[model samples]
Target: MAPRPRFSSVPHHALAALRQRPAVATAVFATGLLAATAVVNRQLARKAERENPPMGRFIHVHGVRLHYVERGEGRPLVLLHGNGTMIQDLQSSNLIDLAAERFRVIAFDRPGFGHSARPRGRIWGPNEQADLFKEALDKMDIDRTVVLGHSWAASIAAAMALRHRASVEALVLASGYYFPTYRPDLAAPSIPAIPVLGDVISNTISPILARLMWPGLMRKLFGPKPVPEKFAAFPVEMALRPSQLHASAEEAAMMVPMAVAASKTYSEITVPTVILAGEDDRLIDVEQSVRLHRVIRNSRLRRIAGAGHMIQQTEAAILMAAIDEAASISAGGGSDPRDVMTTNG
Candidate 1:
């Protein structure tokens, strides 16, 4: 073997040229992104890390066991995440802490996210998941409370409002997709749908898939601008675990159909609702969130400038103010555009 001589550093112009070839640069960047989160997220668990403001704790309820962390127990508020992310989506998000101060913020892994058990032989959809959540609330002795959902959970929150309206108080939907359709090619787990095949593959190459997929998306999300080193790693590391992919796949399977079905049902909602979205969110289109705001009467729309789909993390302060405004209206106070950015003060 021959040892090659190394240069001191590549020139700045050379680096710029490499970046110009986006596909090459992005793929390399993605390779690094996936690996970093697993490292930092491991450290996050140390010191018995408290969940944002109210601290995280779990409970057992409904047919399936649930894992949730509750903080500041006054009004029961549930945080549901989008697909491809877990309760960590909220924990790793700015929304968790913002709500913990005023409302009893409860965030959990929906059925298949985080450490929750995936029910056998059940079709996991927004409606079914919402029903299970209502039972969890009942088991926790929470009769009526606001439901906050993001992306996929937005549909679930709507289901709760429409089906179990008596049990729901108000609604907050952020970066939502109202279920009328979904991207099918990507949602299904690469190797899980078969009978004998799922069993064989689950035992075999699943770990590898989790490892590679986690980092790649992180890189893409942060492409134009780099995401903070620490934040990017935690969510992916938490997502690529065992039951995580299985649950993500299941919900994704039912996602498109349920979304299509739910879109038709959106006009049925009569709850006091608040919709917040990033004017620049690249994941779910901003128009979808806007459409939702227009359709649901007694609903308010908030648009944050330059923020992406993960507004809770990217524009934490702004997102909090929007929530505060939502709370004010729900509490019977006069809400105006003036209240929109008031939290900045």
Candidate 2:
């Protein structure tokens, strides 16, 4: 009678109902997690935007808004940065300023990489990006310019040269990844970038994970040579913002396929081409540039000694020299007779 007094209010049927509906508890937990993650993501995004506002102008091309910065005036020299970066990467190295001194420098944030927007349902391959930028250039009345691309962007520059041969007068590819090379680590982000679940993951855990891993990744990217203090000072959190993280992951996921397809057309690029690689390039083997140089009939390959993959940052002088040379060749100055330089260690 004493025990019944305390338990009389609780019904056996109510306890049975709670035990039968565990899924409801799970759903509530999941929804709460997603809601919390969304809130945090928004706060982080706002902070990033406030700290790193757009440093360039925006133009609409092919139904997508693209961000770009233009400086100086002369022959138009277009700069395209690689994965996980924006126009700042080139600007940080002063490549834009240096090239602007002699050429009209136009540095673009490839679709989704910076302030640019990637339209839904777009695959955004190198060819697609090349065509989109070409259209943008057309709208600006800019044509037949030297296009410089670093890392993954090298493929885009090559695609531009091949697909819009008349518009791209020359190409300077730095730390480029050519040929189909399988990289297992690329799959980590790739999986999370797929459709519905990817959207959730990218907005939730991906940005946080990316921020944590970025420091280590930077070290690897500049191995055998230290990352310059200036480059390290870049607003990295901007790149880790949810939208950019998703975009970069998507691009990285598609890289292998893009390279496989683009490799077939390397020999077809007829524009004056300059391939620059660091002798100690840890991200991409210098041999890729060598092979690329071999295939592109009008290419010259230069290997910078003691430089890592980020030649644009660590070896601006060398990169500027290559850009200048490419600009010269594009203006009918002709290629340096030497097809390849001995590796400098």
Candidate number with greatest lDDT: 2
Number of the predicted model whose TM-score against the real structure is largest: 2
Which residue runs does candidate 1 get wrong by more than 4 Å?
1-56, 179-184, 187-196, 221-225, 229-235, 333-345
TM-score of each: 0.74, 0.91
Predicted candidate 2 versus true structure: per-residue lDDT over 91-140, tens digit per residue: 88888889889999999988887788888788898989999999999999
> Per-residue alpha-carbon lDDT of model 1 for 1-345, expressed as tens digits?
899998757677667877899888888776566456444434442222333222345566656877787777577788887776766666666578778888887787777666566777877788888988888888788888888887778888999999998887778888887746457554446445455555444433454566776666654443323465447435454465545655666665665677778888787787677788776666667788778876787677777666667766666666666566566666674443322221111
Worst 10 residues of 1 by lDDT: 336-345
Q: Which residue pairs does candidate 1 place in steric collision?
A: 34-215, 37-233, 57-69, 179-259, 180-259, 180-260
How far residue 313's Cα lies from its native spot in candidate 2, in Å, is 0.9
lDDT of each: 0.68, 0.86
- Model 1 earns a TM-score of 0.74
Total clashing pairs for each candidate: 6, 0
